[model samples]
Target: MTARHRFDPTILREYDIRGVVGITLCEADAHAIGRSFATVVLREGGRRIVVGCDGRLSSPMLEKALVAGLTASGADVVRIGLGPTPMLYYAEASATDIDAGIQITGSHNPRDHNGFKFVLHGHPFFGAAIQNLGVMAAAGDWEEGAGTCEDRPVLAAYVNRLLEGLAGVDPARLAALRIGWDAGNGAAGPALERLTARLPGEHHLLFTDVDGHFPNHHPDPTIEANLADLKALVAREKLDFGVAFDGDADRIGAVDAGGRVIWGDQLIAIFAEDILRRQPGATIVADVKASRTLFDAIARQGGHPVMGSSGHSLVKAKMKEIDAGLGGEMSGHVFFADDYYGFDDGLYAAVRLMAATVRLDRTLAQLRDAMPETFSTPELRFPVDRARKFAAVGEVHARLAKAGAQVVDIDGVRVTTPDGWWLLRASNTQDMLTARAESDTREGLERLIGEIDAQLALSGLSRA
Candidate 1:
């Protein structure tokens, strides 16, 4: 029998397979992904694969179908059951027998959305690899045979491993600190609950129940609005700091005791300072969208700062290539290869954040306060025709080049001016154009935004 399938074009993205569940994605797509991915694994002379799912309402259904497909394609499936995306990454990275892994999750997307993130042989499986799944499925190119599936709950082990991140911190310092955590009612809730119970200090938790409805707020931590509950909790408790997780617990958001949100780049700066102190002169990679302040901070700390593209997968690959001890995206995906596995784990990051603060002998708020101040707009995203997004960025890049403007063309056009820097990039995951500007002063920041606006206007588009 011949088996063939085709995914909605939108679902086969650069980094993962994702879409609105009933609309662009469905059980059939999940099955196809599993079958096709298994073929890829089998062809690579591997058969063991790990699978997991998030707290999304549809995740169980998708996971079942995916497992059936994997087994049908002759791939042994080790089901890790429900958990955050990083737990799946952990299973794949730590297990000596597993050849690849997949996590059914929506990540930071809305409740109605769902997706799959893949790791093959401990490395991110994305970009061309993701697209190739579609190609193979459409062509009915899949292996065949009856394989086996088994359940292995690793949530406790994963939580214990996260505790290791705080291994070297002084117990007295940790016991004295007060912290708040918000799981955003996502897949990370259970893990967060278990983790805090074992940690020292006064711990306050919010929305740690795995509610797929997300009754409190959206799960995305990158949006300031999503962190309102966490901010409020931090302010009310007068805690040392607060940390929040996205839908799948791969990205992290933080707020100081003053209830001030710490943007991803700023978090990177703090982490870099701590990492550099231990690994002196180690390489730290930050996505290009990060503030120049972060880059400068790393360099000032005697670390090598390398700017890479924005996606987590891309950043991870870049980090591996350059042997970077730490890497992060401005969107809150932080990776630490210094003392732990080189993967983005929000729960792990929270632990490390505390360790960093204690080891530095500073309060989280104090560390945040010491950072150089700068004004910047949050990442602005507006829709553009999928085909037009890249072209528009290219047009802006050419114009900036002809004008003799200093630009970093790594992932897009980030034009540097005496006042500040403005970035215009086409988002790889969506049909959207993203822009950001930063400067040392409010006036300079406004001017940088104007430059972005002008470039967009020239491209026959305007910021909304």
Candidate 2:
């Protein structure tokens, strides 16, 4: 007999499940996921699933339907209300009673998109687990029992935890701090509003309201143009610092008081150094796309630095594997296990940055200046047919042997040379090819970029 209700497996991804709402993922799919997840959790002996959602117009409805499925499958539900992805992660990691959680979000995806992030037993639940959920949902094999669903202000408690972790930053030091927060019209907008109220300073806000339409700009700060408002506000207001968040506020980007971008690598580098101070000889992991400056800084601070593949799920998995005190991606997902539960939270990261700034008693510009200097290219994106990007990378990999380049293929290919390193990789979340090059000198960086360009051209792709 055919399966009772089969959820599509194509949408099940390596990290989280995402697709264009109504097209690939609808209320029916959400309900199936809830039932599937409930079955899995029950089989694994879990009784509850912490549920949350972002500001996307589709999120609330999805959460409701998913909860219905969860209750049908004999799993209790704890609703944390609407907030950033990290708040969902925080609430899951904060309490020992909750065994699994799911955040209904689209993250940095376009407005037409929505998805779910799942965590089971304090680890990111993905890959095969997601596929299995689909199978169970389709089979209609989920169990049935009486289940409880509760509503509570988990956001306030989450904010309090962040404040406690950043208690070192005295209110006096913050008085002179004029800050700008670009919420990017995502789940973090509301949370940022509440968190900023506690700090002692004049805080400028942008897109702090929850608008799934994202009226101001796309919610992703990783794209440089999306950061325009924050940069301009900093420049015009002479602000002490500026912070921006991706759709869910799990990833963070910063601008110095001078309006210069403090990229993910640099921001995490600062946090890594502070973490090492607290626990010497600690292990800290950063994705391969991260800058060498971060690795060197971590080593200098007597910490073990690990380079791993890129992807939020991959990094989070590695963090648990190594018992790493911290881990981050160049895309701005920074996980802190030092004093917190070791998940990326833009608000928490911002607080720690504030503390770091105050502890050093230096302006944000001065702190950024304390790091080593190097010439680097911004992450450049070029469209590649989804089917061809991987093949192109494989083609380039095959050619690497004849070229005699130090090709490191952890994420894609990172050709290291005496003067610099250049990377060419396919975006895990999109049908695009991305490249970045860094060097101690500008000439070296140029040469590296030329090599990547030539390689892409040779692979039958054109640079954007």
lDDT for each candidate structure? 0.92, 0.87
Tell me the number of clashing residue pairs for each predicted model.
Answer: 0, 3
Task: Rate residue 11 of model 1 by lDDT.
Answer: 93
lDDT of 2 by residue, 1-464 (tens): 42356655557877889988888889999988888888889998889889999999999899999999899888999999899988898888888889899999999999989999998888888778887887777677778777889975798888888787666667788676889999988899878888889877789999898899999999887788899999999999988999999899999999998878888898888888777776899999998888988999999889999998888888888998989998998999988887788778888988888887777677779879999999999888989997898899988888996778788888888888987898888877677898999999999998988989899889888897
Question: Candidate 1 lDDT (Cα, whole model)?
Answer: 0.92
User: Where does candidate 1 clash, by residue pair?
Assistant: none
Any residue pairs clashing in model 2, and if so which? Answer: 5-138, 6-138, 336-342
Error of 1 at 262 (Å): 0.8
- Per-residue lDDT, model 1, residue 114, is 94
TM-score of each: 0.99, 0.93
